[model samples]
Target: MNPRKSDWQNLDLLLKSFAQISSNFIYDLDDKKVAELDVKLIESHLSEAGHDFADVLEHLCDNIIPQLSASRGPRYWGFVTGGATPVATFADWLVSTFDQNLSKDGDSIASEIERQTIRWLCQLFNLPDSFDGLITTGATASNFLGAICARQFAGRRQGINVAQAGMANLSVEVFSATPHASMLKTLGMAGLGYKNLIKVDCLTGSESMDVADLAYRLQVSTAQTKIIIASVGTVTATDFDDLMTINQLAERYDAWVHVDGAFGIFERILEGENLSNGLEDVHSITLDSHKWLNVPYESGVFLTRHLDVLFDSCDVPAPYLAAEGDKPEFMSLGLENSRRFRALPVWMTLLTYGKQGIASWVKRNIDCAKLLADNIAQSPNYELVNDCKLNVVLFRPTCSGLDQQAADEKTTQAMKAINQDGRIFVSPGYWQGKKVIRAAISNWETQIVDIEIGIACLEDIASKL
Candidate 1:
């Protein structure tokens, strides 16, 4: 188990094998992004219990390598996924090597680096200096942290500590127009009933919420404690809700505002962009560095202006985890007591690629998305479900003399046809009563050629249908 016992020979071998596998995986994707996985049963023979590292590595290369999907490739449009940069990938390797416990008391360097990264992120998002944040598992955990903090903040206003007293006879209302599913899951996990989420109506013919409808909902809500969750970038359509208006309504209603920026929060860095404007006014925010920041998986950020309330919500006093002087202890904050050095990759990414460098890729992805939507719009076989905003293009297959149900079936079939070919991948979901294909371009490697390839696949699939 210890590579050092072999004088680091096995470690060198493993490193070389990793490099080879990475090279092969990237180059092999030229033909296809994914291969059909062979479903097989494992052996139960006791004689095959132990194997050398070299043998195990060889087995993994042969069996597991080809079966994996190239989700980090340019043509993987299945979800809003980001490809890793060379520097960030290397930093991730160092993270695994060091395996440092990122607490405030011990290994203060890791905590200081995390705080510095937070400061850089604030500058990137143009947030105020008074805000504090933490890195979590992903958007789900980030949103969950925001929800729990909002719950606690609301409960405290009523002189109730929900974390200690639980949600016993306490009434707290939540509102969201087109929240990500993770937000609902957060509410459920935070002991707030999912059914209690008052769904606000979106604007006519768009996913953006209607400000008037939100105002009306808030005006009529009887709950003394309220939470309003808004999305800066939705997963399906990549549509941005009216953040300025939502925050205004929240202020009027005396509600805590939480924005799930997720992958789209980077749009705030773009100049003259009014989509996510005033997002900083919210009480809390959710950001996913793994999506647009090109960081590895399980990297998310949750920022809040209410640091006192956040600490009150998740603080757990321990005997040995005391903080020194004014240093903040992360174990008393957020979900986990022991977390990986997740901040290293993010810090390295920001340091290596400055704010302008990262913003360029974001703008590029947005442009590529527009190109995809334009191509879809020109094709007679497909109908654009909505206007392209940010980096998502929502569209579906269409045919003459077909009813709505028939069109829906054709749209779904088109998705299957394209994905089955394995040249590229796109996701399918319902949007405004129509089954639509969602092509999101968040990967740094995505280019106009990738969009062209995806369009070609869809056009061929539409021809057969």
Candidate 2:
């Protein structure tokens, strides 16, 4: 409500300031691996009077910006994270500026953009055109949608209408050899208790699920609604379960199969690789664009072969939505009612970097992982808990002449040191009853040199400990 003449000038100043900060941050990213996270929290309440946008932005830049971890940097290898590509970043800014609702009735063109992007994704993943999908917040949300679909399908098998009747008093059996934690949460959200998840044992000395155990479970299970959760890429170790065998069992038992390919789905892009050979036959699959696609956060995909099942389970009709009819209303198909233009970045990314370009980046990451894994395997001070399959290396520092408890402590301390060094970051995990460090190389910027630096950091920390 200040001078109307000053409004435009002030807006321009704020925009330019933000743009400069963003540009400079990206430009100097290589030099600063991690931000200075030494600032204290601002606990004061909001003021009654609003301040200028420039002042607010300045405060954020001074206080909030430095606390964020540099996950986009070359050596920031943690949590299967990836940095957004230039094309995707630009598209995201456009999305924010346009502020389109991506629903069919809200923005027809934006909705069509999302549909076209979904088609591109299907082609990129080598999936069938008949399969239907929607962009989600992340793998967790995708898993929940997939779970709801499975719940509805399984309830119908037993002459129960879950969508209409709700999971009031139904018992559907869910099984998984190595389900991600998100999958468990999905089951709970779908009204299936977490305690009800029947664990299927893994194959001996391997991270892959035990096909024999799965077959036996299917043979003995009396439940009409059986949902088999298989891992395309496990979180701890990047090992893929035997999808072909699991799908065969599912087909025999008339069960719904859900595969969590959160990060490993990109392995299909690798040359001479069939990482997802039988994935197309599964009932549902979860993929994350933010992980290996090098896109920004809040980008996930939930795809299903059972189009009718998905539509029947998720469709909620309203008087206003009736006219929208037949056209794809993302709100009607998935969880969120008001969705952002999440498709812009994905569409731009796919258009900018076609199959070959994406493949090159993915292959480079896998090669870097192999380089690190090879170095870890040869080092006398470290040993791998699991073989490097895809791009995750699970290894631990060796504490000679120490008990198992002491060795685990030493490994944890080494990981803390690496993270504290601010040059690189790696997470910790327990695999097959052994404590280990998990180094995932999914970032597009990660290279062989980064692998060398990561190894040097690990070795230096381990030696000091």
What tens digits encode model 1's per-residue C-alpha lDDT throughout 1-465? 676786765677778888898888778876754435344544656556697778778878777676777787777777788878788888998999899988665545888888899999999999998888889889999999999999998888788988889878677899888888889988999988788899999887776788898898888888888899988888887778888888888887789999999988888888784678888789999999999999988899999998888888877776667766675688777899888999999999999999998998899999999999998889998888888988888898875688888988888888888888777888887888878888888888788888888888888887887
TM-score for each of the candidates = 0.95, 0.95
Clashes of 1: 0
Q: Model 2 Cα RMSD, Å?
A: 2.0
What lDDT would candidate 2 get against the real structure? 0.84
Candidate 2 lDDT, 267-323, residue by residue in tens = 887768687678889999999999889888889999988867777777767767642
Highest-lDDT candidate: 1
